[model samples]
Target: MANSLPVAVLFGVYLGIVTGIVPALVAWTLGFLFRYVVGVTIPGFGVLVLGISLAGVNGGLLALADPTIVATTDAPTIVTALLVVMMLTLYAHSRGDALGAALPRGAVAWRAIGERTLSVDLAEVFGSEVRIAVEGPVSDIEGFPPLSADTRTAIRETDWRLSADLPIDELQRRLADRIATEFDCAEVSVQIDDRGRASVAAAPELAGVSRRLDAGQRAVSVDALVPTGLVRGDRVTVRTPAETVDGTIVSARSGDPDEPSTAEPVPHSGAATTTGGEGRVTVGVSRADASRLLAVDRAAVIVRSRGRSREIELLSVLRRAGHRVRSVTLGADPPATVADLPGTVLAAETPDGWTITPAADHPLAPDQALFVVGSPETLARLGEVAR
Candidate 1:
C-alpha cells in the first residue's frame, strides 16, 4: 500500500531532524570553537567534508540496526540526504561565525579562568574620553637620522597622555610641535591610531651657525662690546674704526671677551637677554661685508629698532585661514618638481641647504625633504605622493 501525503511528509521531517539537524549542530559547534578558541577559520569545503563524514557514520549505524533499510534506499534518497546535510552545514557554520565575532574574546574562559589572566588595560576611560598611556622612548623611522641618547631618555622618562576624542591628524601635528619645542628638534613626525597609540620620529636641531645662514649670507664672529640685553635675530650695526657693517646677530654671549661663550643662542624674539659685558657676537652678513667685518679686532655694537616681524604675521594669518604646514620626505620615486605637488611649496631642503619657495621646475630627488602649506585634504593627497 502507498503511503499518504501527510504520513510521507512526517517521515521526511523525522529523517531530516535525525540526519541533517544532528550533523549540522556538530559542525556549528566545531566552527565556533575554531574561531573563538583556536582563532582560526574553517573553509566551506572543510565543513562539507565534515558533514559527509558524519552522514556516513549515521548511515553505518542505521544499517547495523536494520540491514533491510540500506537495501531499500534509492539513489534519489541518498542524493537528497547529501544535499540537505550540505545546506544545513553551511547555514550553521555561518551562524557560528556571526556568534563568534559578536562575543568578546575569552568569554567562555571566564568559567575556568579568572579575569586576572587577561592582559592589562593600557587605556583609561572617563565619561566621554579615553586616555592612552604612553611609555618608553620615542622611535625613529627607518632611513631617518636618530635622536640623541639624552633626547631618547627624556622622552622615555616623561609621562604622556593622548586623547582619543581629537582628530588624529590635528593631534599628531600638535604633538609633533610640542615635542619639537621641548626637545629642540629640527623635524618631528607623529602618528596616532584609532586606539590612541602613538609613534614618533624626531631629528635633532642642526648644530652651529650653518643651519641659520640664508642664501648669500655668511656667519662671522666679531669681537665687540655687545650691548646689554642683546639677543639673536637682533638687527645691529658694527661700528669699526674704518667703516660700519650692517648685520643680524646670529648668537651673542656676554662675558669676558677672552673666554669662549657657552650660552645657547636664543630664539628670535623682541625680548632681550640680561647678559652684559665684552663678548663675541656671531653675525649673519652678506658675502661682500663678511670680509670687511672679519678684519676688525673690536668694534662698538649698535642695536637697530625694528617693527613687528613679517614672517610671524604671515604665519599667524595662515593659521587663521585654516592652512596647515607639513614636512615630507621624498620617496624613491617622487614627483618631478615643486609644480607637481598638490600644495604650495614653502621650502625644499636638500644636501645643499634649503631653497625657499622653489620655482616650479626645480628638480626633486629621493631623500630630499620639503615643507608644504595647504588645507588638510590637500596635504593628505600631497603626503601620499611624497611617500
Candidate 2:
C-alpha cells in the first residue's frame, strides 16, 4: 500500500492522522487547569472523543479500499465492511509480536561481534594478516593475558604462529625489544623469513655480564672524554681516591651533550655516577682491575692493552623448545644445573625471590620455592625430577 501510493497523498494522510495529538495535549492542559481553578476533577473526555473520531475516519478509509462486494451500495454494508477490515488489521499486527518472539537466540555470537569488528578494521588497513613466531623467554604478549608456564612451554616447543593485521617490521621490532629489555639477553635476533613470518631469538644468560667484566674490567663513567683516537680495546688507566686500576677499554660513550648529565648511574651493572656534562666517557676494564678502580674517585686517565670481541653467538636454538617459564617448589633431591634438565632452567629460590631476569645459575635449595623456565613436558618432568 505504501509503495503504490502517491508520496504527497501519503504525507497528507500522515499529517491528518497525527493532528489528534494537539487535541489530546490540549485536553490534558485543560484538565490540570480545571482541577486547580474550579476545584473539580476533569475526566479526559476531550482526548477520548478525539481518539474515537480518528478511529472512525481511519476505518472509513480502510473500508473503501477493501474489495468485499455487496448486491447494492448501502450505509449498513459500508459500516459492516469497515468493522471487519479493522478487526483483520488488528489481528495481523498482534501476530507480529509472536513472530519476533519465535526467532532463534544468538547471545554468544552477538557478544563476540565487537571483537570480530576489530579484525575487520585491521583487514581494511593491511592487505593481509601478518604472522609472528616468537621463540624465546617472554612473560607476555601485548594483547594477550600474562602467559602461563604451560603456554610458554608450548610456544617454545613448537613454532607457534600468531596472526595480526599490522605492519610486519613494526610488530617484529616491538616483540624483539620487549624480550630483550625484559629478559636482559646479551643479544637478540629479529628476522623475517621468506614466507613473511617474523621470528625472534634471544640469548638469556646472566653469565654474559661475567664474561664482559672479565675480558676488560674498568666500567666507569668519567668526567673527561677519553681521546677520540683511543678507541675500544686500548688499555687505559682510571684513577680513584684509593688507587689506580689499569685495563683495556671495552666500551666508550661520550655522554650526550644535549642530554644533561644527571647524578645517576648508567643503565648497565656496576655503573658509577659523576657530576656535570663533562662526565662524557665510560670505559670498561677487567674484573681484577675494576676492583681497584672502583674504590677510587674517577680522575683523568691515560691508556695500554688491546681489546677484542668475545665470540658470543647471536642466535641459538631455544633449549626449551620455546616454552614459557614456570615456578615450582624444590624437594629434597633438587636437580643440579649440570644434570642437563631439558627444557628447564632453575631461576631463583624463595629466599632470593623473583627478579626481572631469571637467575638461572643458582642451585636449587631444599624446600625453596623456585622459578623455572622450560617447555610444558620438561617442566612436568622437572616437577617429578626435582622431587
Candidate 3:
C-alpha cells in the first residue's frame, strides 16, 4: 500500500503541473495584467472586483506552488486532473466569459441618464463680461449614459470628487474637446458662464439646443435688437442670470441709449431738403421702433448683406428661424407668434447670445421656433417625432 501511495502521489504532481499549474498560472497572470491596466479608470471598481476574484480562482485551480502536496494527492491520478482542468478551461474559453484568460472582457454597457442643464451667473467669473478659461476633471467625462428623457444628475457618493483649478473658459474648451472624444462626437462645444458653471454639449441639434436652453439659471432680456420688425413692449419672457423671469420688451434699440430720436428725423429748421428746397426721401421707422431707435440714435446700424434686417444678438437666431423656446407649461400649444412668448416662455438677451427657457408643459407647434442670435454652420437635427 505504501508503494502504491508513492505511485499515486507522483501521478498527482504530474497532473497538477501539466493541466492545473500551467493553465491556472496563465489565467491568473492574464487577469492581473488586465486589472492593472483598467482598474484606474473611472467607475471601474465593479470590474476590478470581478477581475481579482477571477484571478484568485485561477490561482487556486493552478496549484502552481506546493508540489509536494499535489504529488501526495496524486492518488486521484494526474491524468484525471489534467483531463478535468483541460475540459474546464476549454469550456470557459468557448463560453466567451473566460475572464481569467483575459480574452473575454466585460463590455461597457450604459444606462441612459436623461440630460439636464443649468445656466450660471457670471458674478464669480466676473462682474462684467470677461473671457475666462475653464478646466474639467479627467475623471468626470462625457461617456455618460445615452440620450434619454430622464433627468441626469451627478452624485459624489461612490467616487472621488472631481474638480480642477483650470480657469472657467479654459476648462470649457478642454471639456469640449474631451467630451468630443469620449462620445466619439466631433461637434462638441464647451461654454463657461461668469458664475463658474460650465457645460459640455453634443448630440443631435434638437437635443443639444434643448439641453442648452434648459440648463441652469441666467439673467436675460428678449427681442434684443434683431431687426426693425421687433419692438419694445413686444412682450417677451426675460431670463436672468439667476432664473427665468417675465419681462416686457424694453427695447431692441441699436446704439447708445443716450441718443435722441428726433435728431435724424428732425431736419434743421429750414433745411433745403424739407423747408426751402427739394424734399429728400427719408425712411423713418415705426412708432414703436422709433421709440427704441431714439435711445441708440448715436450708433450706426449695420445693414445685413442679404436679409433686410439682421439680429445683433444670439436670441434673434432662434427667433429668426422660427424656433421658440419654452419650458413645460400647462398648455398643450406653444405661442402662435413672438408676441405670445412673454406669456409662454422665459427669455433674455446677452452680449454673447440669447438665453431662453420654456414652459415644461408647453407642446411645441410646427410654427414654434428657437431664437438663435448668430448664424450657425451646423443645422439643428430634429427627431422624427418632433419633425
Candidate 4:
C-alpha cells in the first residue's frame, strides 16, 4: 500500500504539469498582447504570477474532469488536493485583476504629470505668456537643450523679480526668433501677449498669432496750445528719435478729471499749461516713433497731415477660417469685444445656460460659455484670457 501511494502521487504530479503547459503558454501570450495594447510596462513579477495562476486553474480543471488521474482510494487526500488547486487559482486570478486595473491608470497619471512639468518648464525659460505642447516622434522625450551663456545671462537679467534695464519687447522678439530657428518640428505655433510673453507649441493643429498690437503703436500725452485743434479723426505726422510715422489722433480731451467736456485747445497759445492746467492730448504713433517719442525729454509736436478715419482689425481672418469649432467657458471675466481677440472668432456665447449668437459689442459676464472657431493656437490663447 505504501508503494501504491508513492506511485499515485507521482502520477498526479505528472498530470498537473501536463495540464498546466497549455494554459501557461496561453496566459503569457495574452499578457504580452495586453501590455502592448495598454502601452505600459508591466513588471516581471506580474507576468510570472499571472502565468502561474493560469496554470493552477488549468490543473484544477483537468483534475476535476478526470479525477482518476489525481485521486486515490483515500477520499480525504483527494479532496485536499482539489482544494489546494482551487486556492492557488483564486489567489492568482485576484492578483491579475489588480494588475489589470492599476497598470493602465498609472500610465495615464504619469503622462499628465509629464505634460504639466513640461508646460511650466517651457513657460519659465521662454516667457510667462509663452505656452507650448509638443507631440509626434520626439514628443515622448523630455527636457530642453542648454542655451548659450550669453542668452542665459540675458534672460536672468530680465527676470521680473530683479531690477533690470533690458527692453521687454526686444527680449520677446529675440526669444521668438531663436525658438523658430532652433526647433525642428512637423509644425509650430506661437502666441504673444500685450507684455510680449509668448506661447509656443509643436505639431499643433492650429497656428498661433505672432502679431503684436503695440508692435507699431506708441502712446503719447501732449499738453500745448496746439492740442485744441487735434481731433480723434485727424491724421498727424509724429517724428521721434527712433523713426517717424504718420499717425492718427486717437483721443484729445482735457486732462482735468472735473473739467466739463467743452474745454477747447488754444491755437498758438504756445503755453505748456492749459487754462485748466489739465488739458492733455493723447496720440497714437508707430512703435519706432514711440520709442523715440518716449525717450525724449522735450515736448512732441504734431502737424495735421489730413483728416481720415481708419479701422484697425486685431482679429485674424485666415487663422479663424476653416478651424475646428469648440466650446469653452468664458470664465468670471472676459475681454470687452470679440473683435479684440487675434486668433479666434466668437461664434456664440451661452449665458444662463442658454445659447445665443454673440454680438461683437455685447457685454461678457461670468458663467458664460463661448463657442469659438480657430486653430489649437486660438484655443490656447483664449484659454489664457478666460482663466
Candidate with best TM-score: 1
Model 3 agreement with the true structure over 1-387: per-residue lDDT tens digits? 223755765664555445454444444444455543343222233433443444445545656676454445533564545455555444333333334344322221111123221223432323222333333422322554343221112111112111232334434655565445433343556566544444444542234312323223222222232334433233343222333333233324343446554444432121112111111111233344333433432322222233434444545676566443322222343334433332333543334454465444433455333532221111111111111
lDDT of 4 at 183: 32
Better candidate number, 1 or 3, judged by lDDT:
1
TM-score-superior candidate, 1 or 2: 1
lDDT of 4 at 180: 42
Clashing pairs in 4: 130-198, 130-199, 131-199, 206-376, 216-287, 228-265, 255-278
TM-score of 1: 0.40
Query: Tens digits of per-residue lDDT for model 1 on 270-299?
Result: 244737877888889999899998898888
In model 4, what lDDT does residue 172 have? 41
lDDT of 4 by residue, 1-387 (tens): 222666655554554456445544554455444553453445555655555566567767776887864544354444344444444444444455455555532233221232212223334444323422221222211233433344333322332220011223333444444444433223433444433344544332122121212365667755533444454545666554555556666555545667455746433221223232335555677665666666654454466654332311223343234344556666665666666553445454543555455566766666566677665434445544453
Clashes of 4: 7
lDDT for 276 in candidate 2 is 27
> Which one wins by lDDT: 2 or 3?
2
Question: Would you list the C-alpha lDDT of every candidate in the order shown?
Answer: 0.72, 0.46, 0.36, 0.46
Q: Which segments of model 3 are wrong by more than 4 Å?
A: 1-22, 25-76, 97-171, 174-387
